[model samples]
Target: MAKVEKVKKKIADIFDLPHDTVLGLPRVTLIGSHQLYIENHTGINLYEKNQIRVGVHKGEIQIDGEDLQLRTVYSDDIFIEGKIFNIFLKEQV
Candidate 1:
């Protein structure tokens, strides 16, 4: 891990803060099987009717679905609605 990551981990552990929240990692939430919320995201990598990829601090988040729509976007959060079929985390390698 990089020195900054190590420091962030230590700080997160000591303060009982969620690593994702403290270290600017991505936090993904699913609502039923049709919606998603992502926080602390960097930007959208890809957008399509069937898939969406979002960049984050150390990796990316991908959502597979049908009829995907970017419902809302904000500085720190994104909402997507569709027939969400799968979600996965991809690390930088």
Candidate 2:
């Protein structure tokens, strides 16, 4: 890891804070098989009925589903609804 990130991890561990939250990483929450909530997202790269790509700190998030709809979107949070089947992360170039 980068020096800054290594230090950040150390700090988070020492303080007992959530590493992702303290280091400003994306937080994804899945509800059953139908909904998703993302926090600390930068923006959406692509949106479609079956897929979504969201920009995050060092990469992007990919969501695969059916009849996908953005239930809520904000500067740092997003809510998606559908028959969510898969979610993955992709490194940005």
Candidate 3:
């Protein structure tokens, strides 16, 4: 944690955000105990060995795992759950 604290000031000014704000806020979003979807996500960071798995298509997504989960949905949402071994996105007809 000391490593993070050391650069706290430089990080604040570089980002032009409040100093404590960065430390104060939680970066994770759209989270549930077993599922989560982070908005504005460009890349994924895996913490555990098999926490989640996802695949992207033209406009659809599929996730899988033993205890896969999702936090919430957009106005356009679809939910499928099972012992998901595969997910294939379908184009709108």
Candidate 4:
């Protein structure tokens, strides 16, 4: 991490803050393979019935499942509903 980021992370750790909230990292929530919520996403890269790709700060999120559908999308968050099977994070090169 950069110096500023390291300092910010140290501060966050010292203060017991959530890393995702303090470091602008993505937060993904899955519920019983039927619902998904992603926070701090940059945008949706791909959307299909079986897969979805979401852009984040330093990487992308890939979701694989059946009957995938986006329930809601906002500037920084997304909600999905379907039978989720797998989720992956791919770092940018």
Candidate 5:
């Protein structure tokens, strides 16, 4: 078997240490709801450590995380926030 190399996507590498590269991933700031079509997104920091407001309005998806050191958003439909130590998941009912 050939050794496979893990090629981190251009976008996924931006949030890593030493922000010297512009990977595909970018800091998104959405005013209203926007239909997102993402395949392999590395990290998403909605806002600073302020607050996040996400919802579906008029057939649009909105994500808002303000004043917080936000992190990864997985393809499995999960939200990641806070430092790894003080992280928790909340069920959106």
Candidate 6:
């Protein structure tokens, strides 16, 4: 990690704060197989009925599913509804 990230991690550990909140990392939440919520997203890179790619701090989040629909989108978050099959992170190069 970088020096600043190391410091932020230390602060988060000391204060018992969520690492995602402290370090600007992505926070992903899922509800069953029908809904997904992502926080700290920078933007949406791709949107399709079967896939979605969301930009984050140092990478992107890829969601693969069926009948995917973006239910809501905000500056830093997104809500998706679908029959989700897979989710993964792709680091930037």
lDDT of every predicted structure (CA atoms)? 0.93, 0.93, 0.39, 0.94, 0.32, 0.96
lDDT of 1 by residue, 1-93 (tens): 899889999999999999987788888899999889999999999999999999998899999999999999898999999999989999998
lDDT of 3 at 2: 61
lDDT by residue (1-93, candidate 6, tens digit) is 789999999999999999998999999999999999999999999999999999999999999999999999999899999999999999988
| Number of the top-ranking candidate, with lDDT as the measure | 6
**TM-score ranking of the models:** 1, 6, 4, 2, 3, 5
Q: List ranges where model 6 is wrong by over 4 Å.
A: none
**Residue 5 Cα positional deviation in candidate 6, in Å, after optimal superposition:** 1.0
Q: Estimate each model's TM-score.
A: 0.94, 0.92, 0.24, 0.93, 0.22, 0.93
Deviation of model 4 at 39, angstroms:
0.5
Candidate 1: TM-score? 0.94
What is the Cα-based lDDT of residue 41 in candidate 2?
95
Best by TM-score: 1
Query: Candidate 5: which stretches are off by over 4 Å?
Result: 1-46, 56-67, 83-93
Model 6 misses residue 53 by how many Å?
0.5
Residue 23, model 4: lDDT of 90
Deviation of model 2 at 76, angstroms: 1.0
Candidate 3 lDDT by residue in tens digits, 33-91 = 34344332223223223343332222233344555544443432323233344333333
Task: Report residue 68 deviation for candidate 3 (angstroms).
Answer: 1.8
TM-score of 5: 0.22
Each model's Cα RMSD: 0.9, 1.3, 12.3, 1.0, 13.4, 1.0
lDDT of 4 by residue, 2-58 (tens): 898899899999999998898999999999999999999999899999999999979
- Model with the higher TM-score, candidate 2 or 3: 2
